[model samples]
Target: MQGDTKLKVGILTFHRTTNYGAVLQTYALQKTILDLGYDVKVIDYNNEEIYSYCDYRVLYGKLPLKTRVGKIIRYSHNKKIAKTFNKFRNKWIDLSVECNTNAQLQSVEDGYDAIICGSDQVWNPLAIHFDFDAFLLSGVKGKRISYAASAGNITLWEKYLKKYWICLHRFDSISVRESEMIQPVENLSEKKVRLVLDPTLLLNKKEWEKLEEPLGNEIEKDNYILVYYLGKNRALTDTVKKLQKQTGLPVVLLGRQIEGIKSISVPAGPSQFLSLFHHAKFVITSSFHGTVFSILYHKPFLVFGNGNYNSRMNTLLSALKLQSRMIDNESANLERINKVVDWGQVDSLHKALKEKSINFLIEALR
Candidate 1:
């Protein structure tokens, strides 16, 4: 490690204040930079004014919901179990307060060493509902590096092509999380985009502790299946009910509170979040992070799709060769409680990807 450089890095995560994934990803990013021997600080991203505290902003902007009603309406239509759009909307409002509340967002721009834009779904136009390429179009004063950034898919937006193309020229270095994202980011930005692991994947199990909850009531470390469901289809619920009836092993479903399921509903926070990943018998998930933790823990899992869900989870699953475990929402058959026996193939692929990704991030930070 270089002792003299004393690098200062700022990570921007569109933290919805009450999100588990956002918090963990931020933790992983900070830990990695700290491991690389730099001064690392997580910007209080849910607020804009907090950006003034850091030298560079690694932003994760959330979707816009202008008013309380707009937020309620936007999240109301979606079928989430534990998370609410209103909660997410409130975070963005705080960010807006931090940014525009003072009415001079640009005034807080002068901070420090480098600004890292992602390792997230930042490129997803729908999720964030903002000009992702805006920083490029408007420009930033400090040296810029896009670290493992991606929206979710491999598709490119035509509206931001010119700016996207130009911004690559400005970046000190650029990296994309998914392998498939490379060609698209390259075709659009015209720069070589390196593939890196999701920031959550950057660290291993030992590091997940700081983000975990108090061990006071940690349900005894037993064999319980970790079911990660985002789809609210009756078929999915029916499967969980039947599985519990048959296996008689309690199934812990991770999400905000939705409806129609009797399985344990874990809130979206640190303690249960880490515990779910740490102690699952096997993981069944539609969430990308769920699959990520399952892989890190060496647990076999079935990855399912959200009803008409988009590309984020699929990209990572495909890259990791766990495609068979993924059940498409349209094609999934909930009646079958099947177990995968010869997942040596999945294990091998995960090992190789893990090494390459570990090498990629380690090399890049230098």
Candidate 2:
């Protein structure tokens, strides 16, 4: 508590996840709250599912290619990614003692003056299964505020409507990441919901630059297109090939070793991830944070959407007036990929959105 000994906040987020976006957003949110003079700790909720997302051993069993050699290669790369992300989590994130079960979370809930869950797909049912109830903080004796929490896809199924309605009403303040999510949440919960920016946007480029400076010019010396695809989108690979053919620039796939595509063998930490975005000649991604860092670095980028994951990307692109940058299976041609973006206008809109998101946090915290 920097100011008047305010609330000790515990942020329950995707901080433990191996995804670059998840870790970065968790850091941003924690930093923002700390800057506001509140004590904060990223609650380290232990769940095997969180670690399994990037684990090659788990994915290896699912992969169609069952050769021992192929399994070993995938396993090693996945371990590298997991190790790198774990290192980042340890260095940048201040975490509480691990809590794996509902009983553990319940026992520790009262330790916080307030609990914040946010800035990621924590509410996305597809990714989180067991801890959904824990995130609700049912037994916690503190203010429950959700900041920029996403519902993943906008189409909320009726099956979970009652559960969400109950959880949404329990929060002291609720803010969703997407505009479309606000309406559905408001409708289901029968409560006012604020639309907020992703937590990563809270910190400026200069703040992120400090982290990148240490990583040096490893990625900067050469011109390359950065491809960060999180989903199994077959068309995205074809699109990347098309981009390579059109531009003649080498494509660097981060944390993913796609067939026939050049990729960084080791998983990159947060700083290294930012450096890749900073030095990229162009960026193409399916992940929301990939588009975010591209915009932060002022790099020319294209966003592609797949399956239920399209809503968040669509909402973000539409808001920033960069809808033209979103391409799909049919429209992902050379000309469409080459479409220019007006960064000046996008920056202006981003500034306003950032302010709104901050205001919501301030009001909720107060």
Candidate 3:
């Protein structure tokens, strides 16, 4: 796709996920690669050997065990959400359906000009339990590129250090979404890692404007607050309720499972998501993608990170100087939450980030 070569590009991501940030980032990366004219495909990690142990018990149920000699059929492992995710994700790209063994992935190297392992925490070793093999980053034989991939926290892990070093050493180019992670990545392999924006930021407000068939400005005419949660923390939930009681505006929630006093329970797609930001009086969310769309639409929002989990939100928010907008759900002030953010300035920053990111992608892919 770059030249006369039809880029049989395969991307590795945590795609069988319901996470909004994960899904949107995948969509952004695929669209970016497609816009570059590459023939792309997305592959998911799967292993079906588990739950068979429990199934063999006579009390609950029994599975057909052809252990004498047979193929390890993995398709039966992923069902419901996994199947649904693949159903929708496969629509975007020609899905990879042939690989069942490590040998298959190795053979796959012959099909593509390059493979990108990116846009999410793909390199995180913790993924092996959920997928067949997560070190797919190390499996590619052609040109390898990793973009905006975070190894969760950049701290030392003796087990992963060697593989991390090897993968980074072998890549043609590497970039991270978080600035704080640049040092750790370099320390691991001495690779000069570029600080690139997330793939979601590659497109501007105008580009997003085209994808979303605009919702009529009917509901947006009234004032309401938007809330999204990523925290398992209870304090964050209490704050959302308190804010709504005091402000007396209806709260429309997204990306959370908690019951709301005055809220609508619906998955927010691009248009509804955009509308939430386009018209919200204010926002309070603990999710990273919630903050992303808020900033994209120039809406003032409060962000809370998971303290137990090492979240990359702090580094990103600091870079944008939106640290003031981030509310520590543990200790929050209702008075300050009411303060409005300057939509004009946020719009300018998003514009600059989008422009810089688009230019970088065009240059890097070349």
| Candidate No. with top TM-score | 2
Best by lDDT: 2
Give a tens-digit lDDT track for model 1, residues 112-220: 4666666676665645455444333234566577766776543545665665667667777678776667887777666667877777877767767555553225344
Worst 10 residues of 1 by lDDT: 50-59
Q: What lDDT score is found at residue 86 in candidate 1?
A: 36
Q: How accurate locally, in lDDT, is each candidate?
A: 0.58, 0.79, 0.64
Query: What are the runs in model 3 whose C-alpha is more than 4 Å off?
Result: 1-6, 44-94, 98-100, 128-136, 209-223, 255-262, 267-279, 308-311, 329-331
lDDT of 2 by residue, 156-209 (tens): 445677777787788888998877787788887788899888999888999898
Error in Å for residue 281 of model 2:
0.4
Score every model by TM-score.
Answer: 0.74, 0.90, 0.78
Q: Which tens-of-lDDT digit does each residue in 1-366 have in candidate 3?
A: 374566677776655564556766777887887777777776544343311222323332343466311223322332323444444455543556655456676577557767777777766555444342334456777777777877665553456677677667877777777777788878876877777777777765666665543444434534887877764656667777888888888777665456556676444454445556666787788777777777776665778766633356776676677788776657467766757666667667766766666555555566
Distance (Å) between predicted and true CA of 358, model 1?
A: 4.7
Question: For candidate 2, what is the TM-score?
Answer: 0.90
Candidate 2, residue 228: CA error in Å?
1.0
Sliding window of 10 residues with minimal summed lDDT for model 3? 68-77
Models ranked on TM-score: 2, 3, 1
